[model samples]
Target: MLNPSHLHRLFLYGSILLSQVLPLAAQAETPEEIACYNDVQGKVAWNQKGTRTWGEDNARNLCKGVVQRAKRISCFEAGILSHNNWSKAISDCAQTGGEAITAIVPGKQCIYNRGGYALTVQWYNPGLIVFNGGDADDYSKYSTPGTPFRTEKIALGQTSCTDAANRAAVVRIIGQGFLNEGITIAVGTSVGIGTGVLGAIACVGTAGVGCPAAVAGVSVATAGAISAVGLALPEVKEIAYIGVPGSTNYLDFSGTAWNVGISNKVPLSQTRNFAKESAQTVASSIKDFVTGGTPGPRSITFNNQAGYVAEMVVIYQIYKDFGNGTIIPIPVTKSSGQISLGFSKHIDIPVEIANLPISVFINGVGTTKNQILGATVPANFSGNRCFKSFGTIFNPQSSNCN
Candidate 1:
């Protein structure tokens, strides 16, 4: 019912509204675009130096292709490297699938060490790259071996830089000392003082105050220089020559001298001498007792029916009980492999006939037996009454004598 012009006006307004609404609906459906917007906003909130929100033109140009979009997401997700070192920055940029770009900036060179070696590193693109020297060559070659170069990958979402300048400075000082003393800085060679490049640097660095000459005696000779360097380091108690080739010659760090040669060792020698003297005394006494012949060797046999898994040790003791209530216990004799289940093994033991009113106690593995023999000479001997305890079973029985 509307006029043509009015209808055309209404259609134009509806088309404009639909056009605006369509883009938003499309954006809502595309999760990647929504994620990009969220990520961009978060980066802006964390606004570190050298980091900025990408402009519309710059974002469009940089985020061209599907691969480029993925790279963009990864770049934003990576942490910002804070230190202005060429090697570290290049490594950081490469981890996020980018190359480090450097530009020469005048009057920013930093000179370190007493040798006046000058180096410059300026972080111009945060995680992207850093400006170093006048051109970009391999940055890793410039780093010293002892320099505590951070090789650990930066954790995602970390934005702090580990300062390597302090550690590098200490290395340069130690390197200069070695060079002045005319000592070759061997990479893996074992110094006489048992210190290498990294160890020497750590020793001086941990001292907090400047390394003193007395701490690590940095002298002209290689041995003295290495020794001094080792002494200067913390946790080194004493340094003794262990007479081994290479760095294995260093003594243990027990704050005491460990003598390696036989010239000064006496403790072990004394122990051996004492053991020999004690053995001789025991052998002489046993010889005299057997030659006296007051009692000949008497044989005692033990028989068992429960087969032993292996040869078991048995100990026998003789105790004489007088009628006056005084009992004397003789020394026990130990014999191994003399007790068997199927066969009987005899043990020759010397016994005094005057000690005839004696009790014989036999114990082997888990079996114990006691036999009371009266004062009659080989006539009043009774059979053994044994109480056996093996594992969880206990059996008390009288022995059958043949």
Candidate 2:
């Protein structure tokens, strides 16, 4: 038999154990464990800056999202951008009245060698066809505008053209140059450079086809849409929108989109896509509002002490976490567009306390978590949010990182 006091003690001890175990047990299934980890400490690539001094090699990956095959070709055509002498090559080809190469499809041919000291090859076999097949006269099949040739002769010419087109496609896709558009062909269509009908060329005993640029005139209106409210969660920022077109994700406190924390959350399919959409949104938005939105020569500065990477990311993150109200009424801004709050110089934590919630006390004095203003956060770090003194409607602890 147990005394009343003993029974009370047993109940109290059991209650304590149950309380701790229950929370942990319940927490096991909660979405909270799929956490987002952030801590600043990575280096920003120097070429990632917008300055021309970064040069070609460095600029390749930096301007990847902003610069495309067509844009690269246009840059070369304009003469300000230079890479692999391709622009010059295209210009030279253009001057000769050769058409600009367009899209390339891959196909193969069997080169038949005629017996004797002389060499002859035949086309018509299974192989990859390349886009951007060059001039129409370049192919051997048709002699003139109305003339049709024998199968053996046509095969030989196609074999030759296939080789040239294939090589060109490799160079175009891999090289830092502009991609050509496509032209109509009797069989269907073929790609070409600059502009004109595609003629297969004979070089290296094979014929090749030209391919068209996959992305042409991709506009803001065409991209898919995303919900802004669902993306407010920190953990979801990493995985949700990085790859989907028109998806939303917060710019980290550090300005760069390709951060460790950001990348870890991105799925394999969306890595390049998320970066592309983000760049387009920011660039297009700025262009709409600012006269010369290029903002040439933007520099990225890292913080040595805390390992913050660049200024743009920090400012962007600030806007993502807290600047929606600042630019709402502005004429040029889109409803989905984000606002920019000028960079801060303070390292005090950034908190979202709209209705003034409870205060956090360290030792009896109130203080917040550390956050740097302006730029220089590490790639891994998320924006600094103070301890969430719990209580309030919809103000969960996850909103503010301790």
Candidate 3:
């Protein structure tokens, strides 16, 4: 379980980072901390510039406008400032920066959950529809009957995503849905889907949330094909991001013939948004795509593949994750239980599948929050096409699947 974001030597540096943010907050309580909030932009932040010569007015102007008063010190971590004009703020201003990771996977950024979990994503260009217990690696043969669809910000219902625990569990359920039906995760690896329910860690298999039989208001007969992940979280935070925009089309394409690639970057940022649109746009929505709908890159009927009839996006109340190492957790509720950790906990986050040409790095100390932990190295990057060891042993143009 070595972290891939940094080198092996960096692994020694892992202990350098305080494991818990709470302890760091406690140890770093300073009178120089200041909280700032820009109501106009909905930005909530804390500042440590109070130790300098800056006054309250100077702090406000320097940190931008705060609706209330700024503090001179002591417990300034409540996040953002309020009007009261006092020497003390409410929150721990020790950790001054927001986590905005710009690496790993493709879709968007990974959002850290203080609840001991996170939301990660993967981008799939043209995306792919994979099956349960199927190898997600074979993007070329995704449509070749019996293969499962790649997971995207799959589905969501009329639930609320504010609850971090339920959110994590629901996302795990989505990964589980594919499993109970016979699969796991990664576009193509033994690493089960993602980590800690969201993405980029380790997923537990126990009893947790259940899929709402309906997705985007339409009933999806799940027939009890998903697993239960009983992961309870303690915090929620943000992670870095980069890559492409996500769409159920990515998931839908997995069930089609178009060879899709990975890396999630862009995001709609709301469950309602992803669900409302994916239901209509993504081909997996049996109610829509099976009947009539607008034809596009996702709607085209291919003679090579049959339409998806049962496998549907089941997670709901999403937070829009584009899996650039980010997965907007879909918060669906079932009876509460813990992800039994029933099986091996080594389930890794999927390694990058270089199906498309892209750019950028997955920036993180490799030990930081939202930075995916413990992934097997020498992750196979070879994909789709049939090349050779030294050169082309056979036909260079042939399929690797062949």
Cα TM-score of candidate 3 = 0.18
lDDT by residue for model 1 (1-402), tens: 999999999999999999988985564222333334444542532224545465643333232221112344444334333443323332443333222111212221111111111111121111111111111112211111111112222111111122221111111111122221322222332222122122222122222233323323321122111111111211112111111111111111110011111011112112223123222321221111111112224544433322121122334446678769998765454443533223334444444433433333334444333221111124133332221111100221223223
- Order the candidate numbers by TM-score, best to worst: 3, 1, 2
Candidate 2, residues 229-289, lDDT tens digits: the string is 1111112112211110111211111111221111122222322332233333222222212
- Scored by Cα lDDT, where does model 1 land? 0.27
Q: Estimate each model's TM-score.
A: 0.17, 0.14, 0.18
* Model 2 quality (TM-score): 0.14
Q: Write down the lDDT that model 3 would get.
A: 0.22
In model 2, state the lDDT of residue 304. 15
Each candidate structure's count of clashing pairs: 2, 73, 78
Error of 1 at 175 (Å): 38
Candidate 3, which segments miss by more than 4 Å at Cα? 1-87, 90-180, 184-188, 192-305, 308-402
lDDT of 3 at 313: 14
